[model samples]
Target: MSAVPNQAGSWSTLETPLSEPIMETLGLLGFDAMTPVQAGAIPLFMKNKDVVVEAVTGSGKTLAFVIPIIEKLTRREDPLKKHEIGALIITPTRELAQQIHSVFSTFIDDHPKKDQLTLGLFIGGTTTLAQDITTFNQSCPRILIGTPGRLEELLTRSQKIVNTKELEVLVMDEADRLLDMGFSQQLSRIIAQLPKQRRTGLFSATMTDAISELVRAGLRNPVRIVVKVEDLTSKGSVQRTPASLDINYIVCDPEQKLIQLVRLLQAELNDMEGARKFIVYFATCACVDYFYKLLKQIGDLKPFSLHSLHGQMDTKRRTATYTNFTQLPPAVPAVLLCTDVASRGLDIPDVDYVIQIDPPQDPKAFTHRCGRAARAGRKGKATVFLIRGREETYIEFLKLRKIPLERGYYRLEDGSVCDNVLKNDDAEDEKITTSEVEDASVAPFIATLRAIVKKDRDMHDRGMKAFVSWARAYSKHEASFIFRLKDVDLGRVATGYGLLKVQKCPN
Candidate 1:
């Protein structure tokens, strides 16, 4: 029943000497044998070979590379000697950087071994470069982990990393994210600053084209490890976010989505679980700021409003927002209104629910957003609301996975489970998708867009172009296209064509 995979996606024999504390933490966290992802990726790291790990979320990826890093700390002479930055870890967001650092720190603290190594967290918004430079000057910290921008800046501006040549191993935690943030160019630049002899490690939930190019650019001939597909985490049947969840979808007018969001927050205030940590996912920075200001004005909700943590926020403010959310108490309900930027790397352990104020970019991103709720074996909930007219997407989502379409308690106010949801039942007969096919899951959505464009459509037959544009844009901003009737209308036929179908989600 454990979510951890053994090897890539299979099971693993627990033979490696992962710091004693990590072993204890695994047991504490309810892990037995290594998960498939961990099993496959660990050996590559152990041998100091560059690695690219592709597995689903929650597959015990943190330890896959951390063990090798720790083992190297022991293999090297004078373990605490900070001659140079021995290890460098880059993450997309401050929250994720802190989370990876914390997990490593926790392992080190608990491990009966590894008492001599000194690890330093070089992050922006709080720890100044001067302080890190001084620490490096003192020459005590062995490992350096930080956000990409800050670390890249430190290497260029400070002589500490360059003088010591301590950048021995580089680990990119959210490899796909780093690629998505358009850091491919930045990563190439940063890697150039370091010696080319170091080992590289990459971990991601998905292997995208940009990420594949990143591996080619960053890693040498590397060990390609794949896990069992069954072990991979995937989309939930009814809830986009599974793991630990009880989701409820509400229906409302497209224009009233924001109103629906506020109403959902109101519902959480009275949940008997009394959990306080929450993240409201939006599709755009404009929505984030708009909701932030509107949420800030609400005085009686007993919730703390967190500002925009998107690309627009300065590193300093972004770091601070991350701090307040993770470190602050739940005296009042803490609501972080954020764009998809915070969805991947950040970890807020106590979060009981993730209120997707807006729909997800696609099924893949939707599941990832819901994943923010449940972490480290904890249960969580995700709710996505669509107005009645737009509800047929329910069947479409479930059909893509071929999982049971059981209708849960997410009935409409009128007590109907399949009410008004559009699904294509005949879509499967086309041989592209089975009859059980539902709305486009994450991958299918992207593939659908690509497929539409692949076919040369009539220049005047906007049927394909409009649908493709709508599908692509919908993957970015669902609400943005609510009014683009041309694309929505076209997509109903061209995007999925015969492959598209509408159906209700099973309970």
Candidate 2:
């Protein structure tokens, strides 16, 4: 079924000026009308001026920039040449590149009368170098999207396939993140290889002084478009103030944090009516991995699965995981367990929740993570899970922006946990006293062997039935229960799947 626009009744008469294919794609994607960013930036970008667009995440930033570029490129009178990277979109992370690339693919797939043009994506988290390089060298994709380092490496090495001089448009998506991750020098190197006359555009959810200087240096007297004025705060409105997004901060201690998260997800899932997919973020892969497995094993509710996108997995697996999740909406609602690296301007819609399983190392990341949901006039929720010892930095971070956090939680005085207290509505004793450190700093990792059963409820007759078998496989590592991607056999899974001749792994 084609996606229907919310305002289809009068959209055709407004001289909206979208190409017939784009209009159709819009209708197919259910984009009812032009967003504020799209409304302002599209026309300016269609004029081919260098553009710097600053808007919050989930504000339809994708279409704001994408429609104009697509409109300009596909409608061009000249035929695109082979082996030339005509349009380049540079992103900060591999996950984002893959995510945006998937979006473009979907949009183009549904677009009618799309020109027969080669498109290439250069992202990490996948180990398909030969396939990617072949596409790069031979296809000369009209639109080239990639992360900074990989794209740069390919350009410097692939003399046989690339013609940077032929590039007509350059886009730096998430310029702040690219710079934050120390991509400034890499960006500069990549820029030097492109034609100076090419049109340049930079898009970000927020702006810092560093990003401003980047725009001035990269763009030619660029047109600046800030859609934040339409942003709302203290409310869920998507169109007007430092004030469209309502900021909700929940303070809890480490003790009851997991329970709080489970409650949060259940509420979000139930309330959203399963419309939005959630991105549950953690500080480290281990945190994500441990929680994901524990939930799967302990909870009898559903066949919940977890995916880790850290460096532990090779590039190919990581790319495949991201591709699978963002390919299209899930068959049913699902949760994405990821790190901060996956948070940025990947336009996933209908997301109502952004759950920070761990507090972000930096404050700016808070905005980016929250941007996942509550998009385009849609009411979304951003929940941060905080513990006691980390209060000083976390509180100071919020204070920097004048946002007040509310303290609340289920409870903290459980027998097992005492390290991090829970968020308490009772503030008389809000600050966790040092005497509560019984469970240890990393209490969450070492689940009580018996409670693991109590938490999941299905270990014996149902979920993760292979835990004991798999756990037996990793006796050397002394992991209580063993595991594998899926099905490596109990003993072999315990010993680490196939140094000899393994059959299967832990389920």
Candidate 3:
């Protein structure tokens, strides 16, 4: 049912069974020891047994699946036959598919048969179908890495472009994200096209009902390996993201959340030196856009460059942003404001911090989001900003699930939250009253503010000053547009932000 990690074995253990080429490549790649997931899953994978692994992001799950597939391909007597796709690895996002492909390419580069056993990447928007077809026709790559939609599109466009019958291994990376992104239909269609008699490996950051159901249907007698915190809590244990990760949360009014987030970034840059990478997760694209704009204009954030990513951005821009952020030089502060799109499987190096503006709907997502940091045994910190009253339930859920979390605070020069907000005369003075709304002269402006507020269900009155400040900068109308809004309309927007009846009204 499950496999325990074999502590005694390392990559060297495979030296006797695997050809010298694979061993030499592993050595060159500087992979000496086996991650627990690798130790547990690789043995089953090499035995031609199907595997379903529940491991966090950046846990070396990519290589666990890649190495065995490469070894199988290399052991084959004949070179990759015409149009044969020896191994197919399907991921949910183009970035992840590209990342995995890069890793595969590096390993393949060191292989003796690098030219014969090639790797191909197929993702939408990155290349034209005709171009992909030509490349496939010329080399007929033995290893194929791609997202579901692009792979499905290619299959429908060309009948024999991918010889599924010749595929020896089928891998689904981030299987949970695939299901969450509503790719189940596309995944089902792709699976139907794949050969039934093949080794299938499904890997995900968490085990969910959908993943379990897919495992039951897609994999036969799969060896299951689920890595838990307890598995890795012991020093020297190999499992999941390192226990060195620091988890914390800061409770604040919904409106001040973004301001506080900016404060955290300011603190990081002020206190630390050298290259630092930070990922801040928002609940929606609207939140990400607003925060990106706010961060660009506010505070002492000018020194650090900012990048925004969401589902709406075109592939080229998203790729460019990812490249720029990941490759930043030392002493440069790089920050990525994104939705869950970046949370799943992209392995960005040297990420020093991860901040969640709001608690994720699923507790499991918190683990993966934080897993982006503390990678490869490096120390990192993860913080979640919670609205004082609303987030207690989510925090409780996290605690009940046994996810580690610490209470956090901002040590600003002015004062702490307790001294500033809880015990200050200015607290009531800063509260916005609902009756203070100035009706907008134009319907379009009112409508625009309503649309923006509707997208964010977590906004509150405490944040109105910040919103107005952002609105004034955003609309180019200065203070006139904000004053023009009817009190009722602004109140409606505040309600959308999760403002309560008893709270202070907008000023």
Candidate 4:
């Protein structure tokens, strides 16, 4: 079934009416209507049936499971003890887990029986295992949310501290990403310990064979719900991303990539009506680190709030950055430079644009990345920066998957690319003609980047590492036919990285 916007479905429309507290909380959260996934899956979950929900990101998959979990716990005939968990939600990343936990908190906090129900977050890096165990023992959270590794460890090593005999619902959020990240073994172990009669829901944006195997193993005669998005551009065609998302791609020389990005960001910052929150995706953690530093040094971007998030950062830093970015005021113009770690299952509010410095190696991730914007029927835009030539074919590759793309242009001002850029579908707009390497602003920007790497040994080392990691990641692209590493120009790629010089990466 395809997901309809909030208008078509409402909380009041559910067959088994939600508890009064749940209804009141939904009203407080401003959720006037149910999304398609919510409308479809909520009733099945309420009926105590296992569900496999495959929906687009930002289609309100969180609430589809969250509400049911709350409803089940609240209506339980046997009240759960403090340490006895009733529902367990396992997502792939800590950020996603945190987001889900927040949603649970929103409903739990407002419910009249909020005091009776408790919530716990057990992801790694935020706290030590001993600390988590202590909290679990003390608080006895009724609903537990965590990542697979920590949840597996907690369930396996400290069974006494983490009780699951009463576990009522088990959810694998972003189920496909869990398998893609090689967490199948952990998921299997976690599932084995849970009671077979418990409700199990596997929620993901894209369904894969591995997820099907997981469903077969974990769920019992589950009802499958696929919430597809209708493509507004073409009739009778389905889109993986939201209809409100405008996906565009920009083709530029390798050396001009950074200049193009800086100019685009500057343009966005200057546009009062444009997006204030931006997510810039880098190919690797090293790239995020290097670019985060590089972009911070640029004079024009200094006034805007710039932050970086990657998988390598310590738990506290990652949690802090995620919290900081999410809580930023709507009026503040902020940009989060991150890797694909920030891509899936994270609901950052009012994200105006998602800029991909490069396409992800995984094809499915493209949909997830764009889903960050244009979420929940809100207007959003995404543009990927691709190198000219063969990389341009990626556009067609995505088209084959029903992901449409439009040409993204570089907006220029006074003979150089400037703000108010990447507004597609305007044929009368003047195209940028300045040679990227020779452009007045771009030439100075590239020089400054090179000089920073040359003068600072640490910065220089970071650039080299980022370039090599990027190349290695590109070589392993799922669509290697298009993003072939050998077809790349090492010299120009190095120039694009602002590296002091190119050096062969040791195999």
Scanning candidate 2 in windows of ten residues, the lowest lDDT window is 492-501
Best by lDDT: 4
- Whole-model lDDT, candidate 2? 0.60
Per-residue lDDT of candidate 3, residues 113-173 (tens digit) = 7766788889978788888888888877888899998888777777666777778899999
Give me the candidate number with maximum TM-score. 4
Q: Write the per-residue lDDT of candidate 4 for residues 386-430, one digit (tens) a residue.
A: 876678778879999989898777654342533333346442423
Lowest lDDT 10-residue stretch of candidate 4: 427-436
lDDT tens digits by residue: candidate 1, 288-394: 65446444544435455555567678877787788777776654577788878877857765777777755665555665676677664567676665533434355
Pick by lDDT: 2 or 3, better one: 3
Cα-based lDDT for every prediction: 0.60, 0.60, 0.71, 0.85
Q: Rank the candidates by lDDT, best first.
A: 4, 3, 2, 1
Ranking by TM-score: 4, 3, 2, 1
Off by over 4 Å in 3: 6-9, 231-242, 272-275, 414-507
Candidate 2 vs candidate 4: the lDDT winner is 4
Model 2 spans > 4 angstroms off: 1-16, 110-113, 124-131, 229-247, 266-276, 300-306, 323-333, 389-396, 402-507
- In candidate 4 the C-alpha lDDT for residue 399 amounts to 90
**What is candidate 2's TM-score against the reference?**
0.73
Weakest lDDT window of 10 consecutive positions for candidate 1: 431-440
Question: Which digits, one per residue and each the tens of the lDDT, describe model 2 over residues 309-388?
Answer: 55456677776777666654544566777767667766555555677865565667777777677667676666776544
lDDT winner between 1 and 3, please give it.
3
